[model samples]
Target: MSQRVIAPKSRGFLFLDSHPGGCRRLVEEMWRAVPDPAPAGGEGPVALVIGSSAGYGLAATIAGLARVGIRGIGVCFEKAPGRRTGTAGWYRTAATARLAREHGRDMVFLNGDAFGDAVKEQVAGLLTERFGGKLDFLVYSVAAPRRTDPETGTVHSSVLRPIGSPHTTKTLVFDEHGAPEVKEITTAPAEGDDIEQTVAVMGGADWERWVTFLDGRSLLAEGFTTAALSYIGSPLTAAIYRQGTIGAAKSHLEATARTLDERLAKTLGGRAVTSVNAAAVTQSSTAIPGIALYAGLLRGVLGDAMVAPVGQLTQLWDRLTGARPLDPDDEGRVRLDTWELDPAVRKAVAERWSGATSGTVAELADLDWFGDEVRRLYGFSVPGIDYGAAVETDVPWPSAGA
Candidate 1:
């Protein structure tokens, strides 16, 4: 172990260094929140979680192993520790593997460019050789800023902006005093191929490719189900969220779900759906323009009623496993953000949104919780970690970079 003291280093939401001990503790907390007693024996259910290192993807992997007793293959692109500490996703993946071993569950981590064909072929080989060529679940929760097209070699970058016109809204930012302040910010609309590029990067093109690859190889298990995570925020964020460039990509994703659902059902009696999740402080969400402000207010209004990733995924598992029947919306998407978009909740949040100002923003929103959640996502501000102590930064991933 290359032991050295590490402290939280940051510029805005970009967390520079990750704490191994703190990451392990946070994973432990998430692990404990789900049910225990993984499947006892036999080659059990199998799951392929693309982008499985952080946020919804990581939580879904945990839910699969701890609650559903499924063997998991996680694919993510993460950096290892070198001159500085590795990415938080790196440490989090290591900790999740440790817990999986403790519970006698099979968890494999493949660190690579998941958007490329090489990693997809690698995953296919694992399924065929190790898991009897059967896959029960494929979770697509990837959040990337850019993607290089495997066929054309063209790179597409996703953007966050209002669709047709510039939208001005109140956003939360820290003042020079490090106090929460509401500031009015206007985001420019998409120009040229901005919408097309975002749809290429964040849309369902890659997801469809993955499904096509596995099915062509005859690797899809009977009754196999796949899902991709999505979001549709309230009116307060509609200009920049539900009706933005990213939203255009999300629309494409949901459309792909319909197409995949039909094809999977015809071929293997399988299913595909997009799971629209609620707002929270995730690595990706914190980067969005107005999500932080909206999420903070949502947290304040719906405290405790706001489900964490693990809780939301556990419910999803129940729906998938026949413990409960699937309840999908008219669009054939599982709506997990119902609570977030409830009329009463929306009314309360809108009132708060309209009345918010720099002075009263902190009081009207759960700014403390929002800040803490962002810190915890990168393995800082986790309870009971001595950040000053020297710790190992060079943690090994069992099969990373292979």
Candidate 2:
């Protein structure tokens, strides 16, 4: 048996079984949010979700299994059980697989580096053997720090920096005591191949590669549809978000959507789209500079309108496979962030941002609520969980046949 230990702060809870109940609650919430099928016996679309361990990917998988009764294949890279602990995503994946089994749905989870060609080959083989070489939908929602180029054998790391010049912004940082503090930070502009590396690590190259491999081997079903998730923030954070290095990468991703759409139409009469999601407190989003403050302010403004990962993915499912046909914005992409960027909402957020300061941050924005949500991402601070209880660190992953 492995022993469990807890981290004081920064990374939040570290005990393996600190909050299984929290994870279960999230799973149940996702299931409850899934819309019922139409009168004509809804379309049960089989899906392959890349990076489907947590956040939007996990929510999409849950919605598919619970509402549509769709068979799913989820490929994600997560920390395996070790001597001390495993990642929150590790436990979440296990819980998701178990919930699918309870619903009489087959949810096959592949735990490995999704950027490698070998993982793609293994997914193709799994589909051939178990799913009859047919996948109706493919969802790409990967967020990684680094990527190793399959063709060049070079490693690329992504950076979040402004594009044009040095920009000063208010960001959240942990103090020596692990408490969150607001600080003014200035980031230099991206230069000397930074954009290329960021694009390479975070862009649509890997997504296109997966589609090409699947299409070539006839693994995709006829009329199959695919979607890659993206984020476009308001003008306030445009310098650091939408118009920054990550923004460049997103541009490439959206461009790849068009290319894949053309290829799918020409080949199997399929379609490819990009879904722009709203801002939320996700594992990856919390790490980005200036995003936390923005999220805190946005949460304060949006309040009830703010949609979490599960809500966003549920909406995506409805738009994709509901009674009505799919619709896209002028840029040929699904607009799921409309509410977040609503004129009134943006105006309120902007006003809050202008008056925000370290002294008044707590009262001006929902920083406490934001912090609680962040802890919830790691299975901590959830209601009904005893934090002092001893926990088993060696919980078995359902996908691993435990």
Winning model by lDDT: 1
What does candidate 1's lDDT look like per residue over 297-390, in tens digits? 9998998889999988888887887787778888989988888989999999989899899888878899889988988988888999998899
Q: Quote the lDDT for 317 in model 2.
A: 77
Q: What TM-score would each prediction reach against the true structure?
A: 0.97, 0.93
> Which residue pairs clash within candidate 1?
none
lDDT per residue as tens, model 2, 282-358: 88887777888889999888787788777777777777775445798767699889998899999998898887776
lDDT of 2 at 67: 60
- Clashing residue pairs found in predicted model 2: none
Q: What stretches of model 2 exceed 4 Å from their correct place?
A: 3-8, 11-21, 35-43, 174-180, 400-402
Model 1, 201: alpha-carbon shift in Å?
0.8
Reference-based TM-score, model 2: 0.93
